[model samples]
Target: MFTRILIANRGEIAARVIGTARRLGIATVAVYSDADAGARHRDLADEAVHIGPAPVSESYLKGDRIIAAALATGAEAIHPGYGFLSENPEFVEAVEAAGLVFIGPSAASIRAMGLKDAAKALMSSVGVPVVPGYHGERQEAGFLAAEAARIGYPVLIKARAGGGGKGMRLVEAPADFAAALESAQREGRSSFGDPAVLVEKYVSTPRHIEVQVFGDRHGQLVHLWERDCSLQRRHQKVIEEAPAPGLPPEVRRAMTEAALRAARAVDYVNAGTVEFIADGSGPLRPDGFWFMEMNTRLQVEHPVTEAITGLDLVEWQLRVAAGERLPLAQAEIPLAGHAFEARLYAEDPARNFLPAPGPLLHVAFPDGARIDTGVGTGDRITAHYDPMIAKLTTHAATRAEALSRLRRALGQTHIAGTATNLGFLRALCEDPDFAAGRMDTGLIGRRQEALTRVPPPDDAAVLFAALAALDLDPARPFLGFRLWGSASRRVELVSGGTLVARDLRLLGPRHVAVEEGDRSTAFEAVAATPDGFRARHGGRNLHARVVRAGGAVSVLLDGRITDFSVIDPLAVEAAGGAAENRITAPMTGLVCAVPVTAGATVARGDILVVLEAMKMEHSLRAASDGTVEAVHCAVGDPVGDGTLLVEFTPAARRPDEAADG
Candidate 1:
């Protein structure tokens, strides 16, 4: 095996690769940008090198800089751990030219599958099942529209050059085709620098299943079963699992064989995934599924595969790079227990799932479960990178057990100082359809309301927070005692823009009553664990915990732990003179484009501007119909969240004397 390898990436994937490399006794080098200087991945590596600025184009995508770092560190190979420069064929060529092994497929293999249109054509020529779509070279908009017309309504326009759902759109009718195509092309150009797109049939009930393929230098290849990644939001996968639930034996065999064939067709080596869109009716057959795209590197959900097969794919990559061929025959790799992985992101699911970036005051992941994370307590979730917090994975003897374990693990994950999608993930795991293995791409979208509903903080939770905030000790004789026979303590909390106050009355050392206006619930303390507290309230048992020093309180509810702060209420006074009518940037990012300017009047629903942050364009819209008083920022400007972009006054209400209608 190679002595050292440079990981040409950052974040959790880099940390994950480092862990495997360490176990195999291979030294790892980490390359970081200015924004990632203090990243966990960089600190975990045997050696670290600074590449360039925080912008990916200046650092992660700089193939020459990465190769130089690898050479300087005496790395035998470079592992492109997904995203950034992972699938770039030119980067592969550069690594090869520098006489350093690129721990992935060859340039030729990447090129064969880089462009969707061309890859589809190639797959068809090789007799691999491909979706019926326009795979032609013609880029004329009219030509593409005509092709979509022939394919019928509800077609998919996908960017040919990139993946990760960046440049994809679904047009439901011919009337929307032109606009969708224009937007898709613009986003495509911005994301991949390629405006080319292909039209394909949009599967109504689709399940994303992909076969993991591994090949070696000796021309041997094998399939490592499959993963069902149907749980997605805006085309980005949110959750994934191995050994697809409800898959028919025949279909499973066909998908495995087809994935292997696809890899062989490209002379593919190392790890790659051939993804397919399958019908959700029943089991996935080779014929029922069509090739969607192929990821040319190690996948983010590889842990689930590892949990099921008990195999280390990264070690295999190292072995193959060191001139080894097929560590084990296809027949020897056995599929064992089921596994599930939930991608926990730092984003607010209620507010349209906007990315939330800030310092992680306290981070506690579920113990006894596999958690792949790059950030720890005290680390900052930078606005310059992906807002992924961690990937929580679990394994069990059965699918039901795996799902149950995952749900419980998600509840135990405690994160603070930044909003997260943990609540949504918890709700999703409890979703009946999801538990029954009947899931698809639209599952989250379909159950949007229930998924985003923030469960009300219960009596026990409130009592715990009150006790912590009041600095009341349970051992004290007068912790909740007062002068009167009935003593009441009131505390305020800020939930988003809403202000809520809770009244608490102590019955005894172990009992307390919490009231929010007309409603009241009683809570009884159980005991404290290593992490936090467990309590029972109104016949509903809950868990709550506290660490009093940092002005933050961690609470465990329904087996899931989340952190909330003791709102000082006095903090809002600090914003005394700031204009309240202004809409500001929510995070640090370049102003990709300003669609509006000073004196431009807009309605509440109008999109006022677009800010590109972390490679995603976030549209800032007017909160109410108003006339612009000032525009503080301009196009191409870098802005931080709360940096005022525009100030406006509500539109004047015309005088109506109950006359003219």
Candidate 2:
């Protein structure tokens, strides 16, 4: 085994690799950018090196700097953990050229599957079922449109060079084809530096299932079963599980065999995933699935596979890189139990899942579930990198038990200073279709409203915040609530952009009556755990925990977290008015484009500015027809959250009004 190794990545994956290397008694070196200077991964490694600036192109993607770091740190091999430079063939070649082992497949294998169009063609040649579409080299818009017509409506146009839902669009009809293609090409060029795209049939009921395959240098190959990653939004996997739920044995066998075939065709080495898009419309059949693409590296969802198989995949990678034989024969691998992985991202589900990048003032994950994270309390989720805060994985004897554990763990996760999708994940766990294993790619999109809807803070939550803000001891009664009997204490809270004032009356120790407006709910503590108080309200018991940080009180009640800003008595409130004419950035990002100039008239819904953040583009548009007064930021400018980008003349007239005048 190599004495030392380097992880050429950041975030949870970097931390994950360092842990395995440490367990194996190998010194680990970590590379960091300016943004990740104080990252957990940097501190976890035995040695750390600064690569470059915050941008990935200048830091993580710089293969030469990384190789130099690995060589300087005496790393025998480099492990590209999943993203960034993981699947880049050129990086792998550079590492090998530097006389260091690349702990993954050869450059040929990655190059074989790098492009979607070519990979589809290769899979077809290798006898793997591939989706019926155009994988041709022609880039003509008319040619692609004709092919889409030939394939039928509802075709998917995706960039050939990159994944992650970028440079991809779904066209339902011919009328939308041209615009979608243009957008996809533009994004493809900007993101992947390749404008090539392929058109494919859009499956109506798609379930994303992929088989984990491992190969050693000696040509020994094996399969690590499958993971169902159907729970997705914009092509990004949200929740994943091993031993794909409700999969027929025959279908599973066929998919695994095909996956092995694809790997063999590429002479693949180390760990790789062969993803398939299967029909969730009915019982899985051998012919009901088609090849999507092969990820030429370890997957983010590998923990579920590891949980069921009872093996360390990273160790396998290390052994394989050291030219070892396969650890076990295909039949000897275990699949004992079910496992589920939930990706907890620092994002707001209400605001279209916008990435919420800010400091993690407080961070507390549940004790039981395995958490893979890089950020901690006082750390920041910056706009310069992916906003995935952590990945929570749970394993149990059954799928139901595993899912239940996942939901429980999500509820226990406490974070402050940024919005998260914890509540949405809890709601998704309760989704009937998902709970019963009848999920599909469209499940989230279908139930998006119900899933993302933030429930108004209940009386219990508001009362908890009030108590925490007041620093009242719930275990003991106080005469405070004004000074006399029949007096109520009024405390103000801001929740969901609205102000709420609750009146609390102390009935007795461990008992309180909370009233908001015309309604009243009495809460009495039945029990108190270290985390929170279990109280009985309206004949039922519930739990509530409150934590205060940086002038904000956050209350976690009944599996939901709500942040309430305490109203300062000495502070004056600002009067509210409709500021719809002002167009500001929703989050920190780069001003990619200002389509409108100063004094330019724009109609409602017209694009004014294109801000790119967290690897996604958002078009800020006109709220209503108005003339632009100024464009504050130009293209290539970095902007912070709520930074005003453009302003329209206040109460600007519509086109019809101007014509009449």
Say which candidate scores most in TM-score.
Answer: 2
10 residues in a row with least lDDT, candidate 2: 649-658
Q: Clashing pairs in model 2?
A: none
The C-alpha stretches of model 2 lying farther than 4 A from their native spots are 484-486, 526-534, 595-604, 623-630, 649-661
Compare the candidates by lDDT and give the number of the best one: 2
lDDT per residue (tens digit) for residues 337-408 in model 1: 999999999998878888998888778886768999999998999887889999999999999999889988
Candidate 1 residue 424 C-alpha distance from true site, Å: 0.7
Candidate lDDT scores, in order, read 0.84, 0.89
What TM-score fits each model?
Answer: 0.93, 0.95
How close to the true structure is residue 499 of candidate 1, measured as C-alpha lDDT? Answer: 49
